[model samples]
Target: MDITRYNSEAWDREVESGNVWTKPVSPELVRKAKAGQWEILLTPAKPVPDDWFPKLEGLRVLCLASGGGQQGPILAAVGARVTVFDNSKKQLEQDIYVAERDQLDIRTVRGEMTNLAVFSDSSFDLIVHPVSNTFVADVLPVWKEAYRVLNPKGTLISGFDNPLLHIFDYEEYEKGILKVSYSIPYSDIESLPKDQLKKQLEAREPLEFGHTLEDQIKGQIDAGFIISGFYEDNSAGKEFLDRYINTFMATKAEKVYVDKCRDLA
Candidate 1:
């Protein structure tokens, strides 16, 4: 099965079902954003720190894998040149709807988040990547591509799930029980039982992966990004775990020129 293709289409169904993330911002929200009264999320709940952002006016920003019409339109409304890139066509349409309705200049692109080849190197000054990396199998590629497309000193603000969330039976989460059923690096394809995987497929659920800290955090460092800021957040709809601990984390990274070693003589 093609996970990327399946997930893409599944998200489209989510849009049709009116999933909260697929909902576009209201005109009032855009108006407020234009007035500089706006906030966006990298994680589930807490708004990103104000200090973590550079000036929004005229910044070349890429809302990488963040196409729910939430962040992109807000950034564009605040004077940032916004491009929303996501795998879901319907998700991108939400951004387009808001952009057209609000008369904001926002570009929407449908593509795999990991393969940012459609964009030129250093094409963006900032990247707002929300908690969508779990949809991809390898997060390192996402980091590498993000690093490639951001300019020197460019910032990449990203949100992702803590691999700790992957260790338990998600079914048990609502029951307020943390049953140890899966490992750190979990996957619906590789980790789920055959029957469970079949059920997931039959239900048209988006398959997911649990990336390690090595891949989620260190991968950015290895990809030439300097980890500068950090914060933890809890999932909004998952209050059972949120009441216990933060299940998500957001990071602020900068792309800077790092010179390679000369030689090993």
Candidate 2:
């Protein structure tokens, strides 16, 4: 399957279906952001720590796989040079919409998360990536590419699903039932039975993968980023796992000068 093409189209359709992630922020939100009264979600509920970010004015920020007009427009309103790179054109359009409406300067690019060749080395000072990477099967390349594009001492704040979130019957989990089923590093492409996969494909639903912590956390270190901050969050009643363990985690990594990072260079 063409994962990129498939997921791209799936997300475009999601925008049409009014998926929450695809919704654009209101002009009022942008106004608030410009006034120093704003917050953006890196996880399900918790806003990213203000200290996790450097000063917004003049910062070059890439909203990686984040194009719903939620993060990029706000960052631009807060005085950052914001670029939103995402796979779905519809998702990018949402950012464009907010940019035009709020008269904010935000650039939108349509592309995959793993390959960021569209950007040059050290092109950005910060990257704000929400929980969109679960759509990709391989995540290490994401960290490596992110490291390549970020300036030294830059910050990368990312959110991703806990691998434990995947070890269950997905449908049952939505019903508030916990059924331990799938193994770690889950992949809808490889893990689902043929009949179920066929159903999902027929429905044109976006296929998802749950990457391991090694790929999520240690991958950043191998890519030369120093993990500086971390936090866990739940779905705020949207997920049953919220009642027990947090199903999502966000990290703040700083690009540092180190021999380990030079390996990637």
Candidate 3:
């Protein structure tokens, strides 16, 4: 299956069905953001640390795979030159909707997260990526592209699911049981049985992939970013796992500056 095309259509359906992530922020939130009072979430629950951001005025920011009209508009309202890139057109439209409604300037680009060739090298000073990469099969390329497009010392704040969450059976999980049914680095595409896959397809749910901690964390480091901050969070819907363990993680990292050397006399 063409994962990109399938997930795009699935998420467009999500937008039509009013998924919480597809909802745009209220005008009052934009108003406060314009006045320098704002907070955005990388994880489901906790807002990103203010210190993770540099001064917002006039900085170029890329909201990577985060075009749900949430972070991009707020950052634009706070004076950042914001561009939102996502695979889902409906998701991007939410950003456009918020931008037009709030009279803020925000650019929306529809594309896959792994391929960011539309952007030039060092094009952005910061990237705010929420918990969207679970849909992508490979995440390392996403990190590499993010590194390539970021300026020296550029900040990247991202949220992703803990691979551990994928280990439990979905049916058992609903009943507050934690029966292990899958391994880490899980993919719904490859792991699900025919019946379950058919059910997910019939329900119009986007497929998910669970990347290991090494790929999600060390991948950023290998991409030349310095991991600076980290936090763990629980899922928002009062899931069974939330009572025991946080199922999400957010990380703050920065591209390091490298100086070219010249031969001395």
Candidate 4:
């Protein structure tokens, strides 16, 4: 939705919305994101492996948003050659700090998540996007970019708040479940401070930033990457699943598949 028009004020509105960029991620919070924590907080019907990251001896991995570089460092420690991309200088600085502290070799680049074309196609073995998609208005572009840059066999591991969760108001429990709270085809309109406009343009888009699982799947397949795994946090329940189905997945997906793509030249 003409994401490029956003400024700092627009971004601040997003932060205040308590939807995207709800709170500034503190160093303490990033410190808490240890490996395998995903499994603990994000529940699944069955246990996924603690060491889900494949052996990193020679994998080329990309970390989006580099939130504190917490995950990037963990991946690098295992010997994967890692690169981290983020739009926020403050956040990337934090990531750099963590990388230095951990003695990791994660390279940082300043860029928007929806445009990964700067990185060559089939250049990476894995991509990690942790709960940051909500910050952007549209995720299809991000998925397409990811698929383009990721090797055919490369894997994408990501998570976001369940859309149903978006319908509730945490401050008022009674209003939490109301479906009319927002349009079913949600739009991410936000207001921000004028001084922050430039940064906002870099950090977020002007359009709404949520997607249904079907949208996520189709966007990826449309970009030429097969879905490998799909996990939804059951904690959000029917409401969120309902929105996800309407926005992302009207048709049930067949078995998710993962295969290797030839290297990008």
lDDT (Cα atoms) of all candidates against the true structure:
0.92, 0.92, 0.93, 0.55
Per-residue accuracy of model 3 over 1-265 as CA lDDT, tens digit each: 8999999999999999999999999999999999889999998888998898999999999999998899999999999999999999999999999999999999999999999999999999999999999999999999999999999989999999999888888878888888899998899988888799899988979999999999999999999999999999986757778877899999999998766563332
All candidates: TM-score: 0.96, 0.96, 0.97, 0.64
Clash pairs, candidate 3, are none
Q: Which of 1 and 4 is ahead in lDDT?
A: 1
Where model 2 places Cα greater than 4 Å from the true spot, the runs are 259-265
Show model 1 residue runs off by greater than 4 Å. Answer: 259-265
Question: What TM-score does prediction 4 earn?
Answer: 0.64
TM-score of 2: 0.96
| Predicted structure with the largest TM-score when compared to the true one | 3
Candidate 1 local lDDT, 150-218, one digit each (tens):
998899999999998888887786588988899978898999888988998998988999999999999
Off by over 4 Å in 3: 260-265
The most accurate candidate by lDDT is 3
Model 2 residue 95 distance off true place after TM-score fit, in angstroms:
0.4
Once all C-alphas are superposed, what RMSD does model 3 give against the true structure? Answer: 1.6
Q: Tens digit of lDDT per residue, candidate 4, span 1-265? A: 4454343244445444543232333444434443423321212222334544566676998877544445666666656788888665545565577667655677888778888867997888877776666667677888778777777667776655545544443235344444334433344454233444445456654334445655655666776665556554443343334433332211111222343463432
lDDT of 2 by residue, 228-264 (tens): 9999998887767778899899999999866676788
